[model samples]
Target: MQLPMKTNRITITKITADDLEAYEKLISFPQIAEGAGFNLISNKQMLGELAKRQIANDNTFGIRVHDQLVGAILLYEQIGQCGFPDEANLEISYFLDPELWNQGLMTEALEKLVEVFKQTSEVRTFNAEVFVDNVSSKALLGQVGFQQVSTVIDPLVGRKKLIYKLEL
Candidate 1:
């Protein structure tokens, strides 16, 4: 709900064009791109454009450690997905630095994000979807109190997808 939301190790802050280089590098990792269900972009111009869009979105946040950008999270509306479109519902998507996986940083960052929203916003639920084989994401969602709500084939990628929801 607020920029620069801090916890013990990580701080959640608004992503800016100044962070473009780091954000691009973070999403450039093949493992992170695949897990986040996006193709790794090879065109510099397109990648920069995409990163700029992310920076411009108010709902997109960078997860930082000691002032260095390590990851990013986005909460937005996806009209036809997990829940009805409204202020009370939003879809969440995130990616972490692959080198930092399994360190529980994402868990802590996500928990703080949810806590802030629960305390400061009118949002009542958060929705998410991950590829069925993305074990870490599923685990992170579960650790943050999200429950599996459905499984369906991802129309864009043809992979089996697991949908999750957390009601607050």
Candidate 2:
């Protein structure tokens, strides 16, 4: 399905095999990884694997600004029994190049994504996990109208992450 591009001057679309290179560049930035609570993307091979998964997954998108790849936004469905309160919800994740920070571009992109999700009818709620130390991300989620529901210490990342959810 082709997602309608919003006025953020970026096209939000499904991730394709051809986008591996761009995805790699965006995730390789240390600031981006740290803010998003993930390890640094070290190589193209890792990106290749990521691209392969994204291509097969229905809930991930490649975000492009002015036809140039900028970042990715993921929406993951909960499986089995999970700690989240809602079963019919999507977990939202995103990262952008550090150079593009504080430009209001990501805010615009996220707003457009929320609109698309609301129209798609796949889920009734959207959620995000932000590292507690990541003030910018917390503010961003708040700007998008997400309310903090809880904080969990991610055993894998060993950091306390704030979980925010929005009901559409």
Candidate 3:
């Protein structure tokens, strides 16, 4: 909702092409990609295009610490995924640098973003889908007050998808 939101330990800003080089460092890790449920991108050109598309959409935010991009949080309208077909609902997705895992940075960032969204938007519900094996993400959503509502097999990936919801 707002640009450059500040949290207790990190700053959230719109992801820009300028941050792509540093953002690449976070996405380059196979573990991060796997945990975030996205395919790894090795080509800088494709990453550049993704940066442009993300910037134009204005839904993805960069998680920065002392001016360096270390991770990202994406909040966007949810449709036809996690059994949420309504456009009023939003899906929360994120990935953080592996080196910063278990440090509580993502929790803080996610909490602040949701708080801001609650204040700025009319939306009352947020949704998140995580693979059943991603314990950390499931824990993160629970910590932020999201309750798991359902579980379904992902036909594309053939994995159990846990659907989480947070109602503001």
Candidate 4:
């Protein structure tokens, strides 16, 4: 789906192979990966595979500023997996270029994602899990109307993750 440009001059669009180079660069930074609770990409081959997988899943969106990919916003639905909410719960996550830190670009992209999905998808809730140390992300989610639901150990991230929810 094509997301319209927002007043902040940002565009959030489905990622494709064309974005792999830019995406790889963004994720290769140790700070970016660590902040997002993912290990730093140590090899180009692994990064290539991950990029391809994201493009294939169609759940990842590229955040572009002036036509340059600077970040990615990704969503996961727990509906069919593990038989939990039957796909009614949507989980949101994102990574940004450290150079753009404190710029409000990420905040705009996230709010836009929530706005779009609430109008277009059957998903009942928008969810987010942030590591306990990521104060900025927690603040952003809260500012966008997501409430603190719980703090749980995330096996994948191996850290205490604070879950936030926004009911649409």
TM-score against truth, every candidate: 0.93, 0.85, 0.87, 0.88
lDDT of 4 by residue, 1-168 (tens): 346546466988777888878887888788877776447556779867877887677778888998889999887876655666566777887888989978899989988887877778787888888888988888888888999999999886578989899998
lDDT of 1 by residue, 1-168 (tens): 557899999999999889999998887788876776446466878877888898899999999998999999998876646556576788999998988999999999999999999899988899999888888899999999999999999887788999999998
- Backbone clash count, each prediction separately: 0, 0, 0, 2
**Model 1 global lDDT (CA atoms, 0 to 1):** 0.88
Ranking by TM-score: 1, 4, 3, 2
What is the per-residue lDDT of model 2 for residues 1-168, given as tens digits with 9 covering 90 to 100? 357465737778877778777776676677775665445445668756765786567777777777888878888875536665454687888988787878877788889888776786767888899888888889999998999999999887688989999998
Candidates 1 and 2 compared by lDDT, better number: 1
Which sections of candidate 3 miss by over 4 Å? 40-48, 80-87
Window of ten residues with lowest summed lDDT in model 4: 1-10
Candidate 2 displacement at residue 65 in angstroms: 1.5
1 Cα displacement, candidate 2 (Å): 5.8
Query: Which sections of candidate 2 miss by over 4 Å?
Result: 36-47, 80-87
Candidate 4 segments whose C-alpha is farther than 4 A from its true place: 40-43, 79-85
Candidates' C-alpha lDDT: 0.88, 0.77, 0.83, 0.81
